[model samples]
Target chain A: MGIQNTLEGSNTEIPEIGALDVDKIKQDFPILQRKVYGKPLVFLDNAASTQKPLQVIETIQQYYTAENANIHRGVYYLSELATQKYEHSREIVRRFLNARSLKEIVFTYGTTDGINLVAHAFGRKFIKEGDEIIISEMEHHSNIVPWQILCEETGARLRVIPMNDNGELDLDQFRNLINSRTKLVAVVYVSNSLGTVNPIKEIIQSAHEHDIPVLVDGAQAVSHYRIDVQELGCDFFVFSGHKIFGPTGVGVLYAREEILETMNPFRGGGDMIKSVTFERTIYNDLPYRFEAGTPNIAGVIGLGTALEYVENIGYEWIGAHETEVLQYGMNVLSEIKQIRFIGTAQKKAGVISFVVDGVHPHDIGTFLDREGVAIRTGHHCTQPVMDHFNVPATSRASIAMYNKKEDFDALVRGLHKIIKVFS
Target chain B: MDELRELYQEIILDHNKNPKNFGELPDANHSSEGYNPLCGDRIKVFLKVKDGLVEDIKFTGSGCAISRASASVMTTLVKGKTVQEAEELFKRFHDLVTQSPQAEVNLEELDKLAVFAGVREFPSRIKCASLAWHTLIAALKEKQEPISTE
Candidate 1:
């Protein structure tokens, strides 16, 4: 390497690579110009949460502005309007997932709360003593601990589907772990930590053969892949709205109609009840039984809008674009010798996790921030995956619809500067 | 790019690469391990304390740059200091990394340790920078050979 290409011993100056037109994307968000550290903020933590577009924001505003009222039950005009709008959002979610029916879609707070609800309802009711729940090693703590609690309570066992050296789930091990005792198989459709797009369709099919229910944690998958609940044949599917560029405090859980009918209610309150008395309470049918309380009204509407926006753009183009950007990022980052790119899976989404030999991921993130580059530097809410990889943490860059090739170049230039400092 | 140069100043990288007082203390009187579960950082801190004075200090771990370098710099500063002095150093280091810069950290005494002050600006890395310090404190609290974060 030339002296200019080195961090210290070698020569490398991170080039003046540009990024997405903040001015253009900012036109959509209307929050990008705000100052942080007295500079333009580079928001690189998309995997944690995504920025909302004007359409989603406006949907929330419009909901409150024109169609704000309590839904279902009320006979008044405004109440009916709110009920129709709310139900319309459910249809959007149904179409988004290509679910069999709107009844399959149950709204919750987020993916964590959704998973916990299933653990409490489905896992608690149907799962018997000594039954097994298989999850991949790449699961976030949210996916792991709930089943752990379920197993402890039910005397069931929690089995792990191990990953190979490339951070991909080992199909052989997955098959070995599943048997007559296995009741549920919950796995991330795309790993948040590694960005590996799992073969969930095949995984779900195999589980179904054993009469085992599968729950695909689509928190990281929804934004990257085309999800069809029926096509995948998964018993249940869950994802957070925020991860798909929607509002926080909103999530969707899709369960088979029969499964939803069988599972008991998780929480008791208004709206979930069909008829209430001092002696006995009758629960509402389908989704309303699962969704108690007032719910995140505006959040759901905004999520519908977010879904509409994504559907308009189309997942095929988005997936192709993001995959290309990730490949380009890997190529650009490879130019810097000291940088060690992690998680090179065969089927990956837009995420790229890496480490520069001499520089820490935190230092790299901090340095990159100074140059208007944003990325995540941690175990990414998946500590077990980190342990599997035998790495403390890896700096992650996840691309969305808005990210461009120039963004990858800027990231490369930022890594070059990190190398310069460390070398 | 120029601004990033300031964040990853040469001194920080030097400490990261050829860390001072690196390695393990085989005959250590005290040791402890610290882990940042969120990031998977694991650091083992070893100390040789004789008559309330820290005669030797060392560390070993694989982590992000901030963590490994933090351990590296911590070992260099704590060695040859009294246990009480080491405790105070811990306090100073904590303030230097977690809190605002106004807190007095004894810059000359800090030497290479000062390079890590920039870490405070990045809130997520605070745990990485403090992993070794927490382990050292745990070691002192137990007054034994050591313990691990797990």
Candidate 2:
């Protein structure tokens, strides 16, 4: 089970009409061709990590097989080629987020890494005792724990904005939590557990009014639709490449050029510094200062391909197709009398968390696996969400572009079998 | 179907529905919590030891079928035995589940617990199946901190 994060979540709601050629798109992912337990795999765990396309898979294969060299510091022809490919991916990410410059787009291992980078660099420089950091209750452990550690080490305290019954955050509570000592507002763009798309623009506007920076944990929302950092005006945005059908290791941390320039380097390493003497060391420019050591060269390149793959297909159709599938899934699952859906937010993407009556999510997971249906069952690294809901665990079926109505049918069938067997 | 049935046997299901000794022992001298972080299953084991023998035992908290049943049956078996015998039983059960399927170690000597023999087939569920036993050890050992099966 994957337990992961943000938004450049702007105004793209599920429109009344748009569609993707999902059958054709499914062919692009080679793993979809295989079967598990003599049954065709109905993958519904996209929120955990997406199945990579052939385009991404081959790009990685091509990189290791032919173009393998350390980037940023190279003189030879092969090294130069590798550096260009690496930097080219950064430019691709910049365009994807519509960030002003490449200086703002820092390559990270994943969303967790990016969040930690901000926590360590920004927290050290700016946050001190009695200062406050505000986060919502529904944050993935990545977003919560880093701030918690920052609070613990720096003597700064953390404040939480609570969510209501429908799994939507109380904006009133969020606004109240913001006051004079509030250094930053860190919130997820889309909840990985609840699939609630946050009103990040409003949150950003509120925080900007107070001159407090906001970090949108966009790990879940990036692939759902297009994300424009400039449009959202968020100070920092972070997302994992793997969550969007790219390689696992690469992610993007889009700090606004001004904010990126303010923080110190997260880690000290070779490429992160411009020059180093015995007495002193000078760190590299804007994003590179944050990107220490040798980056995930192949992963970055593969993420570039994944982004291009999404671009070629178009986000409008992807959003509409996902909305339809999720709606159909909710409709069919609601018909089951025993099923109690968790995260019933009006706006959701790529996740359905639920618990069946007289059946534990763990058993449901085991039974589903036998039928070759893949779903996640656990806290999903959101213990607060589970605690607030008062369930030990939940069965989650998350979606991606490759999924269809048949996947929902298959899940409903597997659930029915579980009920029958238990009964 | 065979594996699924074997895993969720009638006895296991029955125990899961009506777990034995499922409560806290208010008079207990020793107690410890066992946590399966994977599923967020937590069970607190409370033992009343009198003159080196486990006079009474009970568990309180929640978990899945295999774990709940295992804890239920374990209380029934360990109630009358000495702490030494309980430890031996833990070793035997651990061997039964952790050993490769090809390695035949007979569980005929143990009752009800043999239902957990199927757990070795599903590697992920093995931790779920054994969390109670680990907690039992911690309780007997007088460990203060909660034990975690990470």
Judged by whole-model lDDT over C-alpha atoms, candidate 2 comes out at 0.88
DockQ of 2: 0.75
lDDT of 1 by residue, B44-78 (tens): 77888889988888888877666777787788778
Q: Which ten residues in a row have the lowest lDDT in candidate 2 chain B?
A: B141-150
iRMS values in order, in angstroms?
2.4, 0.8
Per-residue lDDT of model 2, residues A1-423, tens digit only: 011001111211222223457888898889999999999999998999999988888878878877788987779866877777777788888889998898999999999999999999888899999999999989999999999999999999999999997899999988898899999999998998899998899999999999999999999998897999999999999999999999998899999888778886798988889999999999888778887889899999889888888887888889998999999999999999999988988888888999998888999999899999999999999999999999989999999999999999999999998898777
Residue B4 of candidate 2: its Cα lDDT? 91
lDDT of 2 by residue, B57-148 (tens): 99988888888999998999899899999999999889889989667656678665788888888999999889999999988888343232
lDDT of 1 by residue, A45-123 (tens): 6788888877787778877877788888789877776676667779889989998888899999999999999999998
lDDT score at residue A394, model 1, on the 0-100 scale: 84
In candidate 1 the C-alpha lDDT for residue A110 amounts to 97
**Full-model lDDT for every candidate:** 0.80, 0.88
TM-score of each model, in listed order: 0.89, 0.95
